[model samples]
Target: MKCVVSGGNIKILARAIQMLSKIGEEMFVQPQEDSLSFRSVNGSNSSFADITFHENYFSYYAYEDLDESDSLKCKILIRSALTVFKIPSLINKQIETCHIQLDANSTNLCFILKYKNNIIKTHLLPILDCETIRANYKKEGTVNHLCIQPRVLNDVVQNFQQNLLEITIEVLKDKILLRNYIDETSNLSNETRTQLVFGMGEFDEYKINSNTTITFCLKELRAILHFAEILAQPIHIHFDCAGRPIVFICKTLGVESNLVLATLNPDDDLGSQSTTHTRPNSVLKNSAKKPTKAKGKIKSLSKTVFGKLANKYPTNTNTEKIESSDKISNASETSSPNNNNKFNATNSPRVNSAKVIASNSNTNKRENDNSSKQNAFSSLLKRKSNQEIHSPDGGDKDDLVQNSPPKQPSKKAKLIFKKCFQTTFNPESLPGYNNIEVEDSGESD
Candidate 1:
């Protein structure tokens, strides 16, 4: 049989052939003709044919007439190929158990196999030569040739080759888009898309309109293409202008993913831009200027007042002692400074002593004032001693008497006579005095 095998299947078949060659001869020897007759070799052959041929006519014919060694070799090669391809050969061995179903165009094939009560159809590419085993066996005639594809398998091979290219392109595109997502570094603010474009000028170039929508000019598109090529990745490109969302354009595919474009919220945008007013240094400068002017005025006024007071009460003069003494004596006798001044100004000397008399009078007045003060002090002591003896509250009277300076003898004598007259002349004493007066008058008359 003529068979064509795929590169993948060929490798598997080669490995299987090598393994079968290693088994010892006895296990795979063909029976002698006499021994075959006694053991019913024809019956065995018929049974094997019936069991294996029930599936595909190709495998049945390929294995039916084969000697024990050939049959073993065929099974080994087929089993190894199926194992490498990850297909189950044991279940497919039953009669009519597996069949390839192809669409009218023959681009796709579905392998139909029965398992339990249900039939399962697995979709596969129809590009393997094994699918056309009958044609391969017809051309090659050797049973070993049918081990892979038994005939020319060019049509299925071509279809598989082409489909591989398409699958690869699709996978590559997906990988690129994923990489772009992973490596993105631009932290575009979620402001309006227009603002994001402007902010990300270094990464992308676009023109922003008054409406805040951004349009990618030709130059910007070229730059984006170059960026995509450099990054070898796909990216999601969007445009926003002012506060409105615009349809985004994808570079690799013009179609957009089902994503909601971002729009700016009026309240949020306004709140974000609002800031507290910070008073400038100039305000503090103006405030500082006023205080400096006030301080200068205050200092000047204080200096003027202090200077005037200093001149009036010159510290160099010795008038303080005489003035203070006069003021003290006047204040002691009067209710106020005005009353004291009136008393002093009204007082006059008894006689005007000119020159010699003035000197002598001054001396004499000083001596007399001193003597009078001493006598007054002695007389005050005598009066206080007498009051202490006569007063009912003597302890308090004594304390007051001790604290005060002496009074003059005239004052003391007047106080003593007043007290004596009051105590001695009661009404009864008055009658006796009057009778004495009457007798004395009678005698005189």
Candidate 2:
């Protein structure tokens, strides 16, 4: 591929390179059948510039070695390109023409510049492997359109500080406002601000579908404005509401330049106004709904577990208590009458028997069930004179037990206790307590 930029358009090409250098660090060069394309995108990828030099723009152009359908694209450092066109004023006065060529299999691009003094300078820049850079944006049907001369906008931009990074533009139905953009997080006392207002009559052509405001980077805009001023053409601006990309177009004899830039919406900031402020609130609502669902599940589980326990344990507890008390009364009445007579006598013989029981308890730590039964009977007779025992049905316990008739064990009760007394040895026949000699009772005969 080979192309030559003539002496008249050398300055124009240099100014285009200068504009591209300010926007990006690398340049994408694609050689097509009709024109040569130079594209660049900024580091943040928020701004993009595309310049196409048609066959008529170049003095000599040829690329027949490769097929028309094939794509031959290469990437070169913007700084390398800048070295070839260091200064536009010097390039216009001293350099006559520039010849750019690239071989099909070569890794170096050749830049040959001819001077008026008949001296030639050549630079070989190495090609880099990189992905193609492109931006997708719409240019038609924008809500706002302004056709203004380059000098008009340039004059207003000059009033702003050179160090300013961003600027805001408000397009109203009757006028336009330009001002420096200050972040809300910064200290306002140390910053200086400037505002410029222009009426609708100031623009060559003006149209608006709705009032809108936008904030974007100033460096790229300055580049586009500089190029427009150099071409001596009016810049066509097309844009919509905030947070959308803005397009700037400039046309010359055979060259066309299109620049697209990203804009900032004021409402999208952390603590800005409430216009369209539902994103953060919706996020908080979604986060808050999760815990309530878990709590509901836990409450439901607790209710189900309590219900199961209530069904397992029935509510007829009083009947069980009455049945148990009746069994105790019948057992007491059925006890041997001789054993009761011995404990019921209130004489010195009872006192002597208690002393013998105390002596036997002290001598023997382990005793049979017969001795335990005797102790229990004696304790009951002693407490009878002091406290009256009440049955579950509100009857006197002692009278009920004494009047009840002795009852034989039912078949179920005998079967339940048959294993307990199956041993051949009888507990009652053992003569430890049965052999105890007692004095005669002191009843008057």
Candidate 3:
């Protein structure tokens, strides 16, 4: 693929390359029968740029391999390409024609610049294998579009701070607004807020089907504005709501450039400090008056303190069991035919504590006299045998819950075995326990 750029158009081509370099590090060069396309995508993958130079933009253009299935499509470093047209001002007087060539089998992209007084400059930049970079976007049928001279918009942008990173545009029925977009994550107290309002009459052509706001990076927009100013053409902007890409289109004699930039979505910062900026002014007022997380923290602390106190001073289990037994006995007495009193002594709130204590002691003595280690062991064995007989597999009831190795015992089983035979078993009877005890006793001796 070979194309010759005349001296008159060299400046425009250089300006194009310079503007592209600010966006991305590499540029994709693809040749077609009708036009040559240069595309670049920024490092963050959020911005994309494409410039198509028609055949008329070049003095002489030829591509013999256009019929081939695999045409010459490659990428070169933007730095190398920028060097060719480093000084656009001098190119008009010193250069006659710029010839760019890329062969199918060649690894280098050759540039032959013919200079005045029979002087010549040649640069061979190495090419890298790359696929065509294309961004899928709809530039038409958008609800918001504004077309104005580049000089006018550039003047408006100049009023903003030089170091501003992003700008927000609010589209209304009667006017348009441009302002510095302060991020929610930033320190709002330290940042200065600036906003500019322009009436619809200020634009050459303005059409708005819906009112909305969009925020995008100012770096790319500034670059585009400067390039449009150089080309001496109006910039056509088409955008939708936030979180969608906005397209900037510039057209002059034979050059057409398209820039697409992603916009910020306020929903992305919903739960952060930045939410105030995205919400309505009325909501902001309410938000300011509302309390912070301190109230929630106080409630949580109260809950935790109460919970710990409840766990520390537990209810009396012994008194609860005695009260339940007393109620049962009173109900039986009232049901008997011999009962004559309408009010019983036990029904009173105050009870005789000595009588209750004596009765509990008597019951404890009776239980101790009847129970034995052998009887307790036999009872436990009988319960185990009953469980196995009732079970399908003749195994412990816990086996039903898990058939795997290392099964977990049930809560009922643990409760039934607690302190059952602790006094009867002698730790020294075990071989390991006896050895440890003998060594300790020998040392003492």
Candidate 4:
């Protein structure tokens, strides 16, 4: 089975993966003729997320289902997916189309990234058994429904203390209150508690059958909010108290998406709180000023906004066919570029991919193979895309990891990666990309 994702859609998928990866390590991929879906659930089952990108989301769409295989299903380490999509800037400005091909006969999942210069890099991703995250949340029982702007909620959550584990949310008749979550094991210290209250004017709707209050993990909420902020959309929250999970549904009015995030409520012990109606004028009497809304600095990918900003380029033509691993393993094509895809980077700047590849290579100079150039380009494509990319929370994320740091690519490697990553353009076509000339190089050869 094969599916193509344009750079714009790739950015959307990348955002979804970045958000979901915050909660789970494995991602379930389900592909259909109409759309492609990605799902994930945290290890403790405390959170679940799903994102769908429809056919129009990609410039090209193709699906072939066999009687034996009704659909395409595979699971990959979210870490790998994140590594692959680490840079939104690259997908937006440098890369054009991303082709995903799944062969039932093979173990590795293949991704052929077509860039602006008619240059193509192929990545083989490892996979896990098929697994889907299913949410059995009951809708009828939901007692509270909130429609708040992502920015508003994001502002409120930002005021929360960094050390706080969770935030208590109270839905009332006139406003919503977000305060430091306090439990039986928690302290009532005025110096530690923080609170922010937003009137109905801050949200589109704040319907509450009852004055319900619940607390959810602050970090997780922040992560979800980042997704919403990126989309610049409203957040629809539905929940029934502190036992069942809370559901966050977000949508982009003009974009194709059905992004939903679910996080289980804290134990019932935290549920039994002082009713909002009975509580005094304020929930917390903290000396700290009312949680002030602050817009934290957001780190940018490549300053290249995500969208359809260029033309499409195909993977290969009959003349310069890219052979599959199962056949002609040793054959090397004359460094010629194959132009077949829909978008072209005729306007994007060109860089020396062969040189970039060489610096990103981890193999010894004496061992460079014909494939080394190919590996270098592909690896640099992935590595450079990650450079300067930030986490959902505005933190500078490590080169290729969520929490841990990636090994520093050698200085040569950094220079290689930067050359391709740092260019801005009056777009130009890479005329000789398809007919590449490789310098003779060994061991792996």
- TM-score for candidate 1, please give it: 0.15
Ranking by lDDT: 3, 2, 4, 1
Stretches of model 1 off by over 4 angstroms after superposition: 1-201, 211-243, 253-258, 262-264, 271-445
Instruction: Residues 1-445, candidate 1: write the lDDT tens digits.
Output: 1112222222222322222222211111111111110000011010000001111222211222223321221111222223332432333332123333323323333334434446553435332221110000011111111111101112122222221111000011111100011001222122111111112212232232222211111222222222233223343333332122222122222111111121221211110111111232333323322222222222222233223322322221112221221233344343434322221211122111111110111212222334468664565566455543222232222112111123356986797667556756465654465565334346555
Candidate 1 lDDT score at position 249 = 25
378-432 per-residue lDDT for model 4 (tens digits): 6555545664233233221221112212346697888756756656722245556
State which candidate has the highest TM-score. Answer: 3
Name model 2 segments beyond 4 Å from true. Answer: 66-71, 268-445
The reply for model 3, stretches above 4 Å from the true place, is 268-445
Q: Which 10 successive residues of model 2 have the least lDDT summed?
A: 357-366
Report the C-alpha lDDT of model 2 over 1-445, residue by residue, as the tens digit: 8999977688888888888998889987767665777778776556778777888889999876755323356778989998988877888788888998877756888889999999899989888843344444455567888888989989989999998877878788999878776544344346675668889887888998888777778999999899888788888898876655788988787677778776653332211111221233433323222222222222222233223222322221111221122232244334534222211211112121112110112111111212476684565555455343323342222212121122456978898777567787465765684665886778856
Q: Residue 8 deviation, candidate 2, in Å?
A: 2.3
Backbone collisions counted per model: 27, 0, 1, 23
> Which 10 consecutive residues of model 1 have the lowest summed lDDT?
37-46
* TM-score for each predicted model, relative to the true structure: 0.15, 0.59, 0.62, 0.57
Q: After TM-score superposition, what is the CA distance of residue 425 in candidate 3 from its true location, in Å?
A: 31
